[model samples]
Target: MIGYVTIGTNDIEKSKAFWCDLLEELGASVVMDAGRIAFIGNGSEKAMLAVCTPYDENAPHPGNGAMVAIDPGSKEMVEKLYARALELGATSDGEPGQRIPDMFYGAYFKDPDGNKACFYQFA
Candidate 1:
């Protein structure tokens, strides 16, 4: 029922580089690269994380109360990716840990474009 998620960015090149390096861990690469927009995928139908310039020609900003949640391969993968995100300049929103006993484990971060995302696993 889900398709893709788009994150706006004022600096398309910077956002692209950020994603390219980050997604390299998941074996994803640029599948669509237009001038102002780009997308990456690792052979998934849902691999549609886009970084784009605002169509209205205004500055890009993160939408309030909006976020994208990512489900990685495992808890260890989540931990690794979350740390890697910080190393690549993303800010930590939450540390990786069990969230709600017997329910889930997760970590959150704000991307270079200020788009917030989560990496989660279930126990």
Candidate 2:
């Protein structure tokens, strides 16, 4: 199973701020802050998302074909989180809607740092 996912960021503070604000609505907060890295989620025991500067010190770049998908629990919350991501400076990759009739409803976007994510729900 997955414990967490770390997205590389050139601007640690900016990335942390963006994620903190966006995930706050889901009761997730900064569970740990170790200077260049910050983990956000409900608790350390649960899966969390980490925004950090690359350890090798190279400029952070989004990896092609990699994405983080979050299940917000309902179609409405998927819509809400998608919109919130945009409001927080994410660029739309896909709009909110069903991807497979009644089976999946999702939205996609790239964060300010260009990390792709999906907010989705399954019926």
Candidate 3:
């Protein structure tokens, strides 16, 4: 139902670094940047992640039960991406594991501003 997703960040460079690393680790490539926005996607260029700058001083942080789930190909790939997120300064919300008792294999992490995000591979 959604055509695109964009998350606001206080520090664009930091957020960009975190996402650039995570996306590359997941085999996606960073494709465009127009000073205020950045886009990342698979080699086919689907335009998945959109990092945007906050428009107002009181704008809410990106994550608050909201999440963006990406297909990282395999369970191991998901795990690695999760770890890399942490290494790039994301905080842990949930560890890598099965979510639906063998139906969903996933991991949850937060961006620098505490936006809840996850990567999953269906089992």
Candidate 3 lDDT over residue span 1-123, tens digit each: 444578888777777788887788556655677777777676423647877786565555765568988878899988999998999889998999999987899999998867788889998
Ranking by TM-score: 2, 1, 3
Off by over 4 Å in 3: 43-47, 56-60
Clash pairs for candidate 3: 63-115
lDDT of 2 by residue, 1-123 (tens): 778999999899999899999888899989999998999999989999999999999999999999999998888899998999999999999999999987988899999999999999988
Which ranges in model 1 have alpha carbons more than 4 Å from their true place? none
**Comparing candidate 2 with candidate 3, which one achieves the higher lDDT?**
2
Q: Which structure is stronger by lDDT: 1 or 3?
A: 1
Per-residue accuracy of model 1 over 1-123 as CA lDDT, tens digit each: 666688999898899888888778888777788989888766447557888998898998898899988787899999999999999999999999999898899999999889999999988
lDDT ranking, best first: 2, 1, 3
RMSD to native for every prediction? 1.3, 0.7, 2.0
Candidate 3 has what TM-score? 0.87
Ranked by lDDT, the better of candidates 1 and 2 is 2
Give candidate 2 misplaced runs (Cα > 4 Å).
none
TM accuracy, model 1: 0.93
